[model samples]
Target: MAPIELKELKDQLQELLERGFIRLSVSPWGAQVLFVKKKDGSMRLCIDYRELNKITIRNCYPLPRIDDLFDQLQGAMHFFKIDLRSGYNQLRVKEQDISKTAFRTRYGHYEFLVMPFGLTNAPAEKLYAKFSMCEFWLSSVAFLGHIVSAEGITMDPAKVEAITKWPRMTSVTEVRSFLGLAGYYRRFVKVSHVWPYP
Candidate 1:
């Protein structure tokens, strides 16, 4: 907290670097130095960054329209849903924008290998690209009853096949928990379809 103590800490950090106990990831915003370990696996130094995230640009992206999604599902009997793994992380920030993504943790300040959730332009740009890709896939397979919310409802095997082809969705869960208006039409699904039959 004192100026002399701070100077001493920095000098110690420099000594650690000189002794091969850390590595640095250079960015235009600031330099992030990381601690390294020796073959014995003991921590050899400390890293810290409380100054970076404060200056990083904040992110804002519009949420996709839900009604537009429902419109895509006009007619279908079965539905399969897909969710992306670390979807935001799948995108790469512009090289110049990387420094803006730096965050300080107890260990050290680190930039993301992919776009992080905290950036001003990240959400809009990333979502736009993702939705645009979905729209393109929908348009290309117009006959598959319109992708309808990155989730789809259709009895068509072709639609199931298409949904399965998506990058992350490998298995389709087929236990119906809610039937909506269609429940009234089925006279026998074992009991009053309005309530749990079991």
Candidate 2:
């Protein structure tokens, strides 16, 4: 992380404590925070919960399809995305399970009073009640690895560029990841042979 990023993260941690989202943790287990650049060029804080997730059982729930979601929104006139900030943090973790979400920052060790990210069933457990499966209507919205808008659904140009410049896959996991990306936009190449699908 850059010096600026380090400062921003410290400020973010202080804010999280002030906001009562986290508390000084004395837990034996701890996770590290991962920062990533968002689309708007702002730093987004995330926790790497790979070790914890490996031991947790997954919820066998199916998320609704993007195409099916769009089909429902076909005739709607008004469109605006419901933007929630620190969405996962809005939900409280069980008192006993709070220790599981404890994380370490450069500043200090802290545990989440609210739900933390990277839990296998976190989204389903927290946001499931308020969840609505609807396709986003925007100038250009990334939907399921593809871009969609009023002009119609299309492959994201970045993904196309990656596909063209991408190296040959050596491992099964790499092949699956590559094929999974191509599979979404395969309709564009095989059916329409064009940029946007009608």
Candidate 3:
């Protein structure tokens, strides 16, 4: 780690400790720490939880469908895009599960008191009901990669641009991957049904 990043990591750890989000741990489990560069060029601390996630039971909670969420917006004249800051931190780790979320930093080892991102079973739906931190829009808003409004949904321009510039598929796997991505926005395409791969 660079000296500056090491300092930032220590500062972040201290802040988390002060906020009661994490505590000193002597758990047998330890996951790796990751420092991701944020848009502002600051380090965003992340935990590499792949090994833990492999052992954790998957949460089978059904997430709301994007189509259904858009359906609910049909009659609404206003839209509020809720952005949860440190959303995962808002949920508590179960008493028995806290040790499982432990990770080591250069400073020391610590475990999360709150749920952290990258956990397989961390259901986020309940967090939406807890806060009003959001931006209000009069008619339309970009959501789940689509611009939605009372006027109806349209593919976000960026998504359309991606589809346009998608590399030509040379392999079966690539074709499947392209189809899977394009299929997500199939509603935006005019319905001339038959698609034969030429």
Q: Which of the predicted structures, 2 or 3, would earn the higher lDDT when compared with the native?
A: 3
Deviation of model 2 at 2, angstroms: 3.8
RMSD in Å for all candidates: 15.2, 6.3, 3.7
Model 2 segments more than 4 A misplaced = 65-80, 124-142, 145-152, 157-183, 191-198
Model 3 lDDT tens row, 41-123: 97888999999989877877787888898888787777777778788898998999999999988899999999998889787
In angstroms, the error of model 1 at 174 is 37
Query: What digit string (tens of lDDT, one per residue) describes model 2 on residues 65-169?
Result: 877986765554445554455678878989999899988888899988998777878873334323363434445566566665666666878989998988977
Q: What TM-score goes with each of the models? A: 0.32, 0.70, 0.75
- State, as a TM-score between 0 and 1, how close model 2 is to the true structure: 0.70
Candidates by TM-score, descending order: 3, 2, 1
Candidate 1 local Cα displacement, residue 162, angstroms: 35
Local accuracy by lDDT, each model: 0.44, 0.77, 0.86
Maximum-lDDT candidate: 3
Per-residue alpha-carbon lDDT of model 1 for 13-73, expressed as tens digits? 5653464433344554443434445457733323233355456555555555645555655
* TM accuracy, model 1: 0.32
In Å, residue 186's CA in model 3 sits off its true spot by 1.9
After superposing all C-alphas onto the true structure, candidate 1 shows an RMSD in angstroms of 15.2
**Residue 173 lDDT, candidate 1, scale 0-100:** 32
